[model samples]
Target: MENLIIYPENQKQLQILKSLLEEMKIKFKSEEQVEELQDWQKEKILKGIKDIKEGKFSSNDDVSQKARECIK
Candidate 1:
């Protein structure tokens, strides 16, 4: 079996898609119905956010320079 993903623009479109899928008897899961994030994933995301708030990240130029140096 193959899986398909769909992104409806607005609530109306989403409702229409859900209705159509129900009419066709096709099973589908919406984003809100998905499982919760794992603890490690959540921790990493929170750490990244904290680092950003603390201004601990490097600039794009610094990253590019490092990349160029590594490529040498």
Candidate 2:
């Protein structure tokens, strides 16, 4: 069986689509799609959050200053 995805903006539209499908005797399944993150991606995000909490990141001004020094 092939799966088709439908994106309805509101409840009214969803109900209408459901009614249409039912009237036509077409079988359909509605489900929420979830995106799973890779282990490395989760680890990187956690590390970034931890670094922020620990005040371990440089400020934009510091970065700009370093760039200017390098360009000189």
Off by over 4 Å in 2: 1-35
Quick one: best lDDT, which candidate? 1
Per-residue C-alpha lDDT of model 1 across residues 1-72, encoded as one tens digit per residue: 889888888999989999999999998888888999999999999999999999999999999999999999
Colliding residue pairs in candidate 2: none
lDDT for each residue of candidate 2 in 7-35, tens digit (9 for 90 to 100): 99999999999999999999877765455
- Model 1 / residue 4 / CA error / Å: 14
True-vs-predicted CA distance for residue 8, candidate 2, Å: 5.3
Model 1 scores a C-alpha lDDT of 0.94
